[model samples]
Target chain A: MTLVMAGAISHAPGITGREKMAPEDKKTRYYDACYRFRDHLWDQKPDALVLVSAEHFGNFFMDKMPTFCIGLADDYQGPIETEEFLNIPKTTIPGAPELARRIADVAMQEVDLGYSQEWSFDHGFMVPLAFLTPKWDLPIIPLNINCQVPPLAPLQRCHALGKALRKAIDAQPERIALIGCGGISHWPATPDSGKINEEWDRAFLEDFVANKTDRLLRYSNDEIYRDAGPGGQEVRTFITVAGAVEGHGGELWCYEAIPIFAVGCTVVNMDVAA
Target chain B: MSVYYLDKLMYQLNRDPMVQARYKEDREALLEEYRLTDEERQAVLDEDIGKLYSLGNQPQLLMHFAALVGYAWMDYIEAMRVGAEKYGEPQYQR
Candidate 1:
């Protein structure tokens, strides 16, 4: 009952100030859509926000990468060095450690999933939050999915993890808003880097808005990788949010293939049943 | 050998500003801490990104490495393409 709202947004660093250097029209389209998404999220007015995002070798490295991690600190610091690319003011966001602990406990106990308690957050969590809660007032529970490394959790597992998160949230007394921050398409470092798979991006968004959650989850990692590039693996974060809001449909708030960012930016507001 | 060591080196370079500064200051000494092979070290030193890609380095980390080595965005893409051609397709593409 505590899960009041759920949503997803693209967290391309370009969506930060980096997009301004792009073509004026592209910049306007991306910023306008982001503003609309931000306004809609602000209207939710939830007590806590649960953010699911990917780590870009920020917190963990190849030496010690966890498949998933949750922030358990009382307050979380935003990315410091990313200012050159993201240009967001460095600040700390409040953390819901108690709720985070509950979710971690549930994940560990029921699902046999081990998670790390780490506080560092990168652009994935900050970019959307910079827009959604610029003042950094809302208590946040950050959940990280391993999108950058190989042996990633399957989309099916991500959905199940979402369900487990919902169970954890249901146990909390505070009103919660879940935000999945990631992507639709675009490669970051490969030969195909900077290319947006418009066809795949539109199809994914269409399926999401039409409530084809199953279809969305059906795409294997290889399929997604081959079609949308390795960065597209981040969409598993969106799938996790969808799992948390099970049976609830979604409305596409905004979507654009911003070439400057090399990402198909998208935002969706989930319709949770009252 | 796994390409993981390359990723580890890149991660160290990306997360630690001091290491990055050191990389710019004394590339050889900083790289010594990492167990990179001679070819890997040479590729990094020469900024022969294509050679690094051929050596099984992950593109995600390579992208950051490219940025650190002063590659412009467009040039980074070109580097990856040229590397892919020279090094055969990346592991992911293969």
Candidate 2:
């Protein structure tokens, strides 16, 4: 078996934390899209889900941040925000250390990756997991890109990491699914929170689903900040996914800017099979 | 302002329950442990979400700390807005 499924989705904490605040129809549609994404993932019957996230200082700190990191543990705990804040209970999620180590060993051949034996899931990871694997039954391999801080990894490097990951996962015998979790264009957790640039989001998603590496890598940090806000930097996660599934275009499962969620809530199913 | 130390305090407060408990039980003592300036220390002591935001604190860290200090989602956003108005723009973006 090889890579069976690949995609990306929004992981705004407000999506879950402020669920009741959003309009009913909008929330329902967005959530339904997420549920469908989950079902589509399970249909692939993957042995592990490599959840790529832009961690918000839950485990990584400014003191020592890794540009890209993967968890190498038997189990991990999450929702570091608080059951009250994220509206998701703290719980343990299983990890596939064996598969993760193999992937890491193979991935390092092409890209530099920091690894940890211990990690606690922030909303970046928890928010998506809440919808994608509600039962917490699927084993996960958490991967993080430093989207919170600047002097960040270059977009090209993120794409390279994705290519390496694709190579590594393909070498493994187990079926694996990969999902990048991030906001498209919003100012999260800032005074400007709830502001979304739908135009910018759609443009990015267009390049993303098209697997147009050059276009996706074209965005400068300054331009991104000016148009999409800091949260838009998380596109690295999506870019990596696009790199992993190169030459394959994707279908837009959903895209909607939910203000309370502080992001253009999005879900894209990459054409891995194609 | 030492964004590093400010971030360190916030990182601990966000992830470590023991640190959160210590801050809750005896904040002044805990505040003294971090090499924070008077302004930073005071901001934490006051639970000033807006000032912290203006002081260049990371929004994610501030958001969690706001919750620890009893900020509802909207209140936290509003605090950042009000703080920006009072203290001027934040040194950092996001």
Candidate 3:
């Protein structure tokens, strides 16, 4: 059985390289929570961590949309600065071509799933890995979802797709854990721009961990706009995790609002029920 | 302004603290809490076109404000289109 753990967030200020944060205070609470989340994943000692996330123009463009993509490289590295991107060395771990084929086949029956041989790890995958791995032998499989485009998959579609991924992983017979990374609530424009929806953030975190997604998964873009804040757009990442963990039910591992990037960081642990 | 144009402008302005804060009273604190420099402070205050265009530290915000400006400028284009249709290009006929 695969142990699936995940989070939906912008960059937690304490973790993101964007700004400096004070230590030993509620202000640093997100960082404190991050450390605990890391310990939990490490304790699981799974054979590999399969991460699903969005890429910020790293492997795509406005010209085309690739619904699903897989990284088939021998190694992945990052946190690219203007001059250098921290590079790490590791086995690419097999891309699971058969599993990909099956998952893609299933998803296509429901929605579109694009397959790519080369996709790099962007911050969505890198940030959590930076903390979670801290240094480990297990490999990473990068799954990219197109949330930024006009023709984005519905929140419910992403969740169902994750359910497909669970079956795909089961077919592989490998010890695997899944991590969903993205957002809590963040505008990502000006540090001053995003309007953090405290009520929605708290509600989102609470509802997701409890595996109560019937309502969340149904929010159309129009409804999302009417009720959820603009930053609520990030909640799609959480929906995917809900699909992964909802079967067994998830426990809220941690939740924190880090103001640096105007992001909310949350970690969820699930012992998926068979 | 056309409703479509006004709606686009609203979306762009939505990313601005000036605009975002409009929805909530205490939004000013969120704006002030961030350590923005004096120049940025002034640029936002002035609604200076050049400063607005150049502000890239926050692409989402910068692009949003730029979009607002674009929407406003589009109104001028619309007016010109109406004039052209009425005057037939304002030709100098000998």
Candidate 4:
């Protein structure tokens, strides 16, 4: 019962970088939702936040990409993009290395989890942190899923990783908050950057909130790419969160299609049995 | 096509500040390091992100390079659109 909170959200760079570029009213509504979500997360007061993220090429690259990599450093520096570009200052965030190592050690028994002594944050982790942990004081345990490259971990594996993490978190004495950040449906960083499929996103969110493993895993990568664009491939993160909170349902705190933000903005809270 | 090398160059240029400084100070010398095709070299030299996009550079890598090269967010989006129109859809994986 150490998993105090588990949920998912969107982490598009535009959520922070291009904040002012979007319409004012829409931006305020979205930010307000983020504020409420943050309040709820902080209320749980977990000892460590396990951020399951899908990074761009900030740390690992095509040279050698890992299927899953958890940070094992004492501290990690981030928003590797220029401060002028990402609009989030590069800062060193303390890491929960001992907790991370223990989780990795246990999770490896079920999955071949990789551990990294060195890692940096891209917009994927930065944007979410900018919203959820504005103070940046909470110790973090970052986990990465290879959502960008092809041959991505299958949806089932993403779920399995979540289940494994649940076992790992339960064994720890610390209260752990698990949050998965990624996509709903959108084309990001391309010509179709501002395009979002609201219908597709809502449908997927329905499946996600219900924790419908079968329905969530029904999407093939090709179908996601075709319907949700390449960015949609990041649904693996959400699928992983569902796996962590298996059998428990979720609440869709917020979901809005903010085109300038690229992906549909989403915030969800999952139930954790006492 | 040396798209893999081209992609590798993008990855390095985005990750390494020294590589970025070199890219800024001595474009030709920096370009010489990677096994880029003439077209790839020209695209980097020309700052033609559209061509790079069409050449199958991953958008994740290409986007940071776009920012590095001083593209505003809208400009980066437009560059990809124009590139797609001029060069057809991106030639991903090849």
Q: What residue pairs are clashing in model 2? A: none
Better lDDT candidate (1, 4): 4
**What is model 3's DockQ versus the real complex?**
0.08
- Model 4 CA lDDT for position A121: 91
Error of 4 at A272 (Å): 1.4
**Candidate 3 displacement at residue A53 in angstroms:** 1.1
lDDT of 3 by residue, A1-274 (tens): 5544444434332245543442336446665566777777677676566777876555554446676665545555453221112233322233444445554564456555676766555556666776677664556766777655446677888888777777666655556677777766554433233345567768877777776768667667655544543445556666776776665566765665555445666766665665
* Stretches of candidate 2 exceeding 4 Å from the true structure: none
A128: Cα error in model 1, Å? 0.9
| lDDT at position A266, candidate 4 | 92
What fraction of native interface contacts does model 2 preserve? 0.77
Chain A TM-score relative to the true structure, per candidate? 0.93, 0.99, 0.82, 0.98
Specify the highest-lDDT model's number.
2
lDDT tens per residue, model 4, B22-81: 988999998888999998899999999999999888998998899888898889989988
lDDT of each: 0.79, 0.91, 0.54, 0.89
The candidate with the higher lDDT, 2 or 3, is 2
If scored against the real structure, what TM-score would every candidate get? 0.92, 0.97, 0.67, 0.97
Query: Residue B47 CA error for candidate 2 (Å)?
Result: 1.8
Interface RMSD of each: 3.1, 2.4, 16.1, 2.1
Comparison by DockQ, 1 against 4, better one: 4
lDDT of 1 by residue, B1-94 (tens): 5466777888778777888899889999888888888878888889888878778787767777887778876787787688778777756422
DockQ class, candidate 4: medium
